[model samples]
Target chain A: MESVSFPPLSRVAICGGTHGNEMTGVYMVREMQKQKMDKTGSLSVSIILSNPRAVEACRRYIETDLNRCFTSDLLSSPVTDSTPYELKRAQELNAQVGPKGSEEAVDLLIDIHNTTSNMGLCFIFYSIDWVTLHILKYIQSKMTSVDIRAIQLDLPISEAYSLESVGKHGFAIEVGPQPNGVLRADIYNMVKEAVDHIFSWLQEFNSGSTFEGGEVEVYTLVKSVDYPRDAVTGEITAAIHCQLQDNDFKLLQRGDPIFLSFSGETVKYDDEELYPFFVNECAYYEKKIAFHLGRKIKLTFPSINLTG
Target chain B: MESVSFPPLSRVAICGGTHGNEMTGVYMVREMQKQKMDKTGSLSVSIILSNPRAVEACRRYIETDLNRCFTSDLLSSPVTDSTPYELKRAQELNAQVGPKGSEEAVDLLIDIHNTTSNMGLCFIFYSIDWVTLHILKYIQSKMTSVDIRAIQLDLPISEAYSLESVGKHGFAIEVGPQPNGVLRADIYNMVKEAVDHIFSWLQEFNSGSTFEGGEVEVYTLVKSVDYPRDAVTGEITAAIHCQLQDNDFKLLQRGDPIFLSFSGETVKYDDEELYPFFVNECAYYEKKIAFHLGRKIKLTFPSINLTG
Candidate 1:
């Protein structure tokens, strides 16, 4: 007879790379798996391949976006309603990876991906939370080249669409902008190191060692960028300036700027408040999402979207 | 390359069954191994089958009793020392099952066993810690069929002389007066449940879950039980009302009531103020030093035979 053990406590899951062309997350998972966790007594981790087929195809899910598909509400529903195939899978995944009582309990979730254009080293965006945000600095400190910054840090994510919307915290770690093959290896290591850091922390804590809590930079989404898309690329290169509507619109403060710059230049045409800072740091083409992070007070604006 | 998990928060080494005759702990290990812990999501456990050959023999050890040889001084000596083979193996086994940091990090090290006589179900003699005592109850709660009681609910364990002592918080979970084979299934399930419980508690705590700790019963040792030997059956039974002596050569206590009842009636007696509660308990008969346990207030005692 098979003996059944309770659901594990701390764990790491590798996602993305569903498209064969997208290899960052898959490679990350492999590397994470290969790394030896000598402290297994303290922590138990299992590696999950989220989209094996999509990972092979090198493109997003054929029918839908898996990321948007996964959520508690859609997953727990008895019927599909108006959800797509990927949406259904997301529901299944949420059930399997959500919390202890629900089905699968996932303490931490990591989604990896390569950017479409030249961008920063690794920029992760998630619903900044108290517990999840606790060790965010530890991750940033371990980085050598790329600076780790949270989106919405500069612009407060509105109350309506805060991190709470996403079950737990999420990290959209951009492994630099796409098109740069050389950086992929470097990106792989950077992401791997972050994952290792999380596991290491878990092992220590599991062994009864504690880390200093507090000190998490909460990123609030002020609003999104809406712009007209070029005929060729269905996606619009985010426009510069305050294009968000005030009806439910909120904008980052004068100094706090966060937005995607797609024109391939630090300077946005038609003088406007852009995710305004350009380091010319890593890559020129990397369409980096700028942010004004590290403030205490939340900047609230009416409902808003920055999708250009 | 072999993957090594993080050093476990706690290690539950299930030995015994060294002699096929006392294959109690082995049964527990088999059940624990069968338990399915969502391998990658939470805590990880490792189980090792110690003394494979001896377990098949159905004897304690080939020549020496492995339990009698775990004294630190003896273990510190050269592996090739003139110590009994049992002592040598003890040296190896102790090092293998030695502590790994935190007090409870290696918490409950249970060695399961069976007695020569088949009278009772199961009983655990722990290091007399409140946590240990509570865990004893937890074990009993999971397996209620057996009468589980701590020898020193209020006593110390330093009563026995001629023994090398280890740390407190250790235990000997005896399974019977003799093996009826039915005990194996119960032993297995008990161990599996216990392992799950401990790991789960550790997991939730590490993940910031609140847990309530409890106190338990224990004993302080005062003296040892000695009996004259037999030449044929090798079973030396203590006569009822046997007087016991302290290391100072003073008559510590007088035995009024018969201590041990082997066949149908009283076989031995105790020398304490209160009669040792025999109550048809399953016990073994052998020409060896025996230890007595009783409850005491705020007491401290050695774990094994003397050299603590």
Candidate 2:
């Protein structure tokens, strides 16, 4: 596949609460809005609360997942399926932020989220695009505490439906171990720090800062594993094993307990070792996802030609 | 207020998951059914999964909460409101477990639940009935690790809508710091031990085991406190303060920090000393309950109630 690059930074959108209970983004946007962070930055920073009603209700969404409603097929339809609350919100957001590559669209978008899983502080990119990789490397260099385990989207980058998908340089900053609807001061400060750093980098680049982009280690998605369920009933009969409950981003070897039934039976991972993230996320309960399996790999980024 | 008593050695029902994601009871009931624990003891033990579909779905409930659907007015209506999934389930459950005071009705009910809050092990009684208090004392006496705090329902016993309200001696066991849909083996074991002890006590009592009930310390519900929110928008702006998070069943002094906002604003308890439980419960988000406040007090039970 050919590599893609980001253009010079102009407008940036910091969107939150695409899934309302993920309060990290919601509060980050709220704080930025309260403090008028947009006025201070040389770059035009638009702080967007993607689903205000869901944020107010402290739910994931009113009708359907806002994150999953932004795919190309869903967006391009003329007689749009605008009945669900999120689909309408998606249309409104796309019109406001992008249709990226369109005139007056944001150059970059940073969507924020929190999870109940022990995912640590990580950036999720849709592809191994050169611009996205360079930005990831820069952020990783600045924030040493950020885990090196970046997740590339399982679906093709073009089919990405997340809020960030509408922007030229869009990605999500997912932080957690924080429960849904409950914000933590530590998580708040960490997210704020990362957001501030991203904008600072953008400001420097806008003022003509360029660098020789290098290599960074990232994890790519393999597949997701669901909790143990009854063959006939299809109801989950076991939970993520005690040893692996919050062990997101950890390597799981063959024969390791992945689930534990109430009857004291243990189910082990029967395959080769793989890194698991988003372990036992509360929001993913609807999807019956216990965890996502991924593999770590080093990807080299060619020095980007920065536009002045 | 008049005190009520329970007849000795009648049918007993142990109900689980009237609100589904509370998995302690679900697992307990599943284990009992699998092992035929119901048949081992002389007592007529009935194991019921209150909302099987929700339990199967691993959700709180498909529609409305089944626990809140058992009011007398709801049960007595000639033309039933069976639109919501839970309402219909409640009617079916009432038909199966009780018409409460009828001959075939369960003599006692134990509804089990698990919470995300740090509410260790607790028993909630709908009324200040003698048999309930005696059972509470017996269990507290037997299990030294158990906290003595108890919550008396604010609603009149006649109007109680929980699954337990359908039994002559009905109460709830709520254990926590456990997340929804994720069963902790420790919590599962703890609930099973309690249920086993309760059954053993019942069997012993029916076989001429007699004892005088005594005074025990109990905590009664004062009221619930909601997290601070944006007045106009009604969106929660603060989280349970770090000091107060996981501080369930702990005494809150007159000036204790309760919540912390994104702007580093700390909101303190501006009232007399009180005990707080169910702090930062995930399920109470819909009700906007940050925590429930209560007061500890001593209550005595009459000894003449041994029906054998």
Cα lDDT tens digits for candidate 1, B28-134: 55434545332423443435444555554434465665655554445566765556666665555555655222253343355556542222433345334443444
DockQ of 2: 0.36
Q: DockQ scores for all the models shown? A: 0.00, 0.36
Best by lDDT: 2
In terms of docking quality, model 2 is acceptable
Tell me the whole-model lDDT of each prediction, alpha carbons only: 0.41, 0.79
How many angstroms is residue A297 displaced in model 2 relative to the true structure, after the best TM-score fit?
3.2
Q: For candidate 2 chain B, which ten residues in a row score worst on lDDT?
A: B1-10
Assess candidate 2 and give its lDDT. 0.79
Over A168-268, each residue of candidate 1 has an lDDT whose tens digit, in order, gives 44455655433211112345556667767766655554454434443443334443333334467443333332222110113234543222233222332
TM-score of chain B of 1: 0.60
lDDT of 2 by residue, A168-241 (tens): 77888888877776666667878877877787777776666666757888889898888777799676787778
